[model samples]
Target: MTASDDEKKMLRASLQSMTGALESVKMSKANTKPRVCLYEVIATARDGLLRRTKLSSDIRKEEGHRRDLNHAVKDANVNVKCKQQLAFNNQDPAQQDAIANDVENAKEEVITKQLEADAQKERVSSLYLERDDFNNALSRMLDATSIVMPFVNLGEIDDDMLQVGITAQSTFMQFCEDWERR
Candidate 1:
């Protein structure tokens, strides 16, 4: 299901505030000339923020897995005593035993929990890898925009200018994109 009405209202309010702030920035006068499209700047900034958030989320997931595994081990260790006690509850060996069965169940539970934690850890690592790639791509884009924007301020908007001369920003973006693919 979707979010509740209250949640939607809160989100809308937040969005409105963000829009107002961005509009203010757009209207502000600047000493430095903006050479690239404003959209490019906004997009690059947003991408940077997204990459950072993804990287942080990956780290949190990895830490969460570690905590989960620790909890599972603790629970199993405590359950060990219970299982042993339950297994030998009967007064005689003549009766069918259950302590062994309880212990086996505990073992299975520990194994299951550990496996789940391991899966989460692997997922976290995968996210981190993607995060790194995105970060590199954003950095390259930022560099390109920095160089292009200044040229644009100088009334040089043609693609031919970029072709005639190699800017560090453009080169860096190309290098980053290539590396990210690998």
Candidate 2:
């Protein structure tokens, strides 16, 4: 009876320890869930920042192109006016006809440049919409990160560290299961 009592006490103590350890593991898993979510939010923000950078560069280039085309249109219009004035002043019908032809060509160039500028304006408008979309997404992500940041400590939550921790937890649980079976 004395030996049996000692064995029972030892078994109860071991069982209590295992239960405590399991509870600790459950808490760790709960904590890890928020950490993983925060990490994903951060990763998405980084990707969005990169995309925004590229988009900003593209917008700047397109805006520059639009400006140049608009300037060309203005210059072409001025050229048409000058050719028309020359045609009016010239007394020679043949020379006036040639100048008139030049004036018409200059008008056509203005039309072409204006069309190009319009296309670029449309492109810039579309790019602005795309940029706005990214900004909105990033803003929402920032809001989420702020909300969860207080709850989750990201100090040791790097990708490799996170994976290793999860793996270790799984392995430890497996070991516990095997020991229990034994």
Candidate 3:
């Protein structure tokens, strides 16, 4: 039982009208403003914090090692002085020569330990600079994202706000892509 031509045309007109109405409603519901990629920003912050923590630990260990090396240098210097005093008191040529050799070896040890301490100090300084950089980078990211609501915490945000933010972000990205295509 096929419909008459007039009836088919009316049905087609009705369907087209309904489709237009639906399209209008969908367009009305579209987001107008852009959203921030909150998830990505959080991930970046977390990574930076982890790296900063590791760098802090490294700095502490390096500083401790440097202090130990400094103490070793001091002890070596004292040993050299003691050997020199002993050589000064001894009259025997052979004993004096042996003490002189001991003093020279102790002096060499002091120099080696001092060099190691200096290197460790340099490493600690570098780590401090690296950690500072990470801190500055994290601060810049937060500033750029406008996430600096001092009293507001991310965990306190409701699920609906998060969903809306994500949707807005997606819409904003699409808009950018579309604009670029032109």
Candidate 4:
């Protein structure tokens, strides 16, 4: 189905918003230096990663919903066709009329299912695009953070510092794995 003007406008607006957010993240990462607090930088990057993860999850859900809708539409179409065939073959006039009505209803159901599937497909596509944009931005931020984090002076080494470093390393590894999975 063709997108309406309003739908197009909404899509454009969403894309623009994602683009702006990604640009902001990129700018922040680019401006990062060794003098910047590693914790704060990591926190910001972690937030972006979380957002990207959430968007990816949403995209997955939308894809599943779209698949279900497509199956429903296919089933509805098959039912309509089967009913139409039955209606034509029936010898009794009354039975034929009843079957014809059933076929009409099935046709209407197919139309409804098709519309729903189309809308769901559109949503899934939009979500995938948004997720990709966020993922790219997050990946850049993570890369920048990794490069700058090691150089940042965190004062004299202590047990607390060691623990923090270990935690950060673990989290970063998990983030990398998650990105790779996607």
Query: How badly does each model clash, as a count of residue pairs?
Result: 3, 0, 0, 0
Better of 2 and 4 by lDDT: 2
Error of 2 at 21 (Å): 8.6
Tens digit of per-residue lDDT, candidate 2, span 1-182: 25588898999999999999999998788667757655665665676677679889999999999999999999999999999999989999889888988998999999999999999999999889877865665566566556556545744344544444344334434543553354
Candidate 1 lDDT by residue in tens digits, 43-162? 645656765786787688687877878788778868977877765676666442556777888888878887877777777777777667766756665666665656666654565544
The regions of model 4 sitting more than 4 angstroms off are 1-36, 153-182
Q: Per-residue lDDT for 179 in model 1? A: 54
Question: What residue runs in model 2 are displaced by over 4 Å at the alpha carbon?
Answer: 1-29, 154-182
- Give the lDDT of residue 154 in candidate 4: 41
Better of 1 and 4 by TM-score: 4
Instruction: Give a tens-digit lDDT track for model 4, residues 1-182.
Output: 99999999999999999999999887556444323445665776777777777887888888888899999999999999899889878899989988988999999999999999999988888777767765665666566556545544443334444445445545655665676576
RMSD of each: 19.6, 13.6, 10.6, 24.2
Which scores greater on TM-score, model 1 or model 2? 2
Q: Worst 10-residue stretch by lDDT in candidate 2? A: 164-173
Give the C-alpha miss distance for residue 160 in model 1, angstroms.
5.0
Badly placed stretches (over 4 Å) of model 3 are: 1-36, 146-182
Candidate 2: the clashing residue pairs are none
- lDDT by residue (18-110, candidate 3, tens digit) is 999998776444321122346554555566567668778888988898899889988998998898999999999999888889989889998
